[model samples]
Target: MEFDPALFIDLFARTFTFWWVILPAIFLGLIVGAIPGFSAANTIIILLPMTLAMDPEVGLIFMVALYASSRMGAGIPAILVNIPGTAGAAATPLDGYPMTKQGRGQQALAISFVSSVFGGLLATIITLLAMPWLSQVAFYLHSVEMIVIMLFGISLIATIAARDTLKGLIAGFFGLMIGYIGADVVYETPRGTFGFLELYDKVPLIPALVGLFAVSEAFFVIEGESILSKRGKEAMQKAGWAATIEGVKIALSKWWHIIWTSMIGLVIGVVPGAGAAIAAFVAYQQSRAFSKTPELYGTGHVEGLIAPESANNGVTSGTLVPLLVIGIPGGATAAIMLVVLQYHGVTMGPDLFMESPELAYGPFAAMAVTYFIMIFTILPLARYMSRITVVSTIYMSPIIISFTLVGAFVPRQYMFDMYLALVFGVIGYVARKTGYHTAAILIGVILGPLLETYFLRALKMSEGDIMVIFSKDLANVLWVGLVISLCIPYAMQRWRAWKAAA
Candidate 1:
């Protein structure tokens, strides 16, 4: 498990030689990620035959490259059109879409691309250096600790609710109620499915995400001629490459923010079942809590955009740690990776590291190389991509609804999901028109089931004692941190008021 400099160098060189494989995967990943409901996991599943035909090492490198770039690509639509291509990008539009509305779409894309690439790259390097110790993270975090972590993400509902507490909470809790539609974890009893078998497996996330964000936005945008306002269109028309350059400069200026938020993603990714959605929200919440200008968040603030984009990409690296070290998949993509690796006869866990150290560590090296190449490959496109905002909503709305409906249908191939997406779209439109935050609702849907599962597990372990959540040392420490984080914003607000009076 010790870091071998020579081995790493060789791995890096070998990975570079696969630029042919890596480049294509990166491009494909970007395309897939830009389209809602298409993710690295499903894409890889479609290409399973091709991957199985390749050398195990080459196939793995391709998957790693695609995973990293896709994480970056999901942010593109989120920044330009307020559509999150993946759940990981859910937090992105809080600030990114606002920037797009203000005609700063190019800068937003530039900032997103730069932060995502560097965040993922730094995280990969850390993964390589700390592989031995980092692998133990999953083992250390049990259901109790995971529940706390889920709460950290769930707390984002409060953050979103700050603008209009009652409506936000109503939306969040309604989403939670929707999330509880499937069978109960322990008894398999249905809660709110209305007896449809499709609801047995819980609400399909792709349809829900597309319904709430893209489809709803499509419905709203039709009322306007363009997605941008008069000033926004003028600003965009006047914008040049300078906007992209300014974005990169702004992102680089917040290097420290990128580093820490990415670390949050890395840690969260280490736990099995923790996905990019949770990481992005937790990072955003923490970032806002510690910021000097919390009021500026949700208003196209650079840090708000940076926090989620960077953190989600950082998750790409963390998701692999458990798969490689403990033979457990951390997320959906990792689960698909496990299938590929198993088919290739690559044994996971510490034994693989001991037997085939090169194979064990090679994916990380390839991931780092993928991220490095992405800066050059994807960065310049930000200028052109920003122009997407200028397209007339007349054409854009139909295109969006069409693609999102297809996206909703692709994941489960259920015609019912397409209809369900329309249902959620109407719900989203109502929420938007009523001043409720869609993100809060989505958060509750995404994290509520996870919270319930972990909470149940912890209670079962403690013989149904509710106090078991505060029993473990690490859990207790995390609870204290959560309290401090929640209090920081209010404390800072009071400090500002006192300073103004003095």
Candidate 2:
């Protein structure tokens, strides 16, 4: 399909016309995203209803732009507080938190901002060039193929489950069971309602996510005496643009690392359900694998900050590709986006490009604009935001809990959601204290339903002949790919142990 210059220009104009909403959305999203526990997906889900009344295209632009920019925004708190604002930014804390302790917080924030812009822009370019072809490929996928794809996507649990295979699997199974609580898709039979009216619709994802990540995080953040108070205001004020420039120099010197990880992000982003957290983690791991001073990785290494930040942002754009072309969400943020698109009455898939290229391309242009704006907006404000780490826990505690509750309830305006949030908050706290990863559990929560729904559908359609899934060339290939993804981590873990023993 040929690019329509006139349509592209018109779409760009429309996107720019909504700069007022776009700008504030990005800015506020950054603040919310930077607050540990308030994830981008949760933020978007909470805010989605407000946008319901707006123009579809404008709403899409605002949310998508906010989603992309917030990935960078979340890094601020991750670096300063050793707490990730969003799951995607979790890897950022590995090196970012250490850097803050070393008085290099400004440098880490700067590198994260610059690398994120670079990765986001590069991914957008790839999205622009690849969307047409990808749309064509997505069009050929039948229901069975989609099911297989979802199963392969769910297998990412194995990579995530690496911390403790049994625990991970158990958490994932629980997530699947939770997802099954609502009415059955085919028979309308309630699976786990237990006579509760709310159970008829299953547990709402936004409230659960907000509770698990944000509200729980608030409790944890306040339980400890303030770490922020440790840094003097004068010392905290040292974070500035000078550090950012220094970070830029380091990133430029290691340009290859950025390019390689950005590519990794792009590839992972294109795969549905892979998400930014995985992209960031894998990139960080790969960067460490290739670094000359691998020992320096988790200890304030500049590349450690750059790789995951870039890769996660890169995945942001890649996540859009499948959504725009195939109507399939590539990540949690993208899944929320799918709702926004459907709410707007815009049907996705191959015909979307043919029928409403404007809607398809509007987000691409907005993402490019988001990248450009984020760099300028973040650099000047990084130091100021970093000082948030200095705020007293007493002052922050009530506010955090207030917003956490508000964020949880805003999505559905239901009081029951507040209780659900509280429950998940407790769950999150317990899990953290036990060394069980909240991220792994959240990943399961995000992907479990899709996996179970599709896998079961595929099996039933094939008359319980599970071999039909393997009978297809594409399914077989994905199955082998899943095996490789699982095995590599195990192999690496063993290698690391052996090297240490030697």
In model 2, what are the clashing residue pairs, if there are any? none
lDDT of 2 by residue, 17-96 (tens): 77787788888778777764456677787777787877887888888888887887877767876656666776787688
Give the residue spans of candidate 2 off by over 4 A: 3-22, 31-64, 74-104, 136-180, 193-195, 221-224, 228-238, 264-308, 319-360, 484-502
lDDT of candidate 1 over 259-359, digit per residue (tens): 99999999888888788988898889889878998789999999999999999998999999999998998999888888888998888989999899878
Global CA lDDT of candidate 1, please?
Answer: 0.88
Clashes of each: 0, 0
CA deviation > 4 Å runs, candidate 1? 160-162, 480-502
TM-scores of the candidates in the order shown? 0.95, 0.77
Residue 348 accuracy (lDDT) in model 2: 84
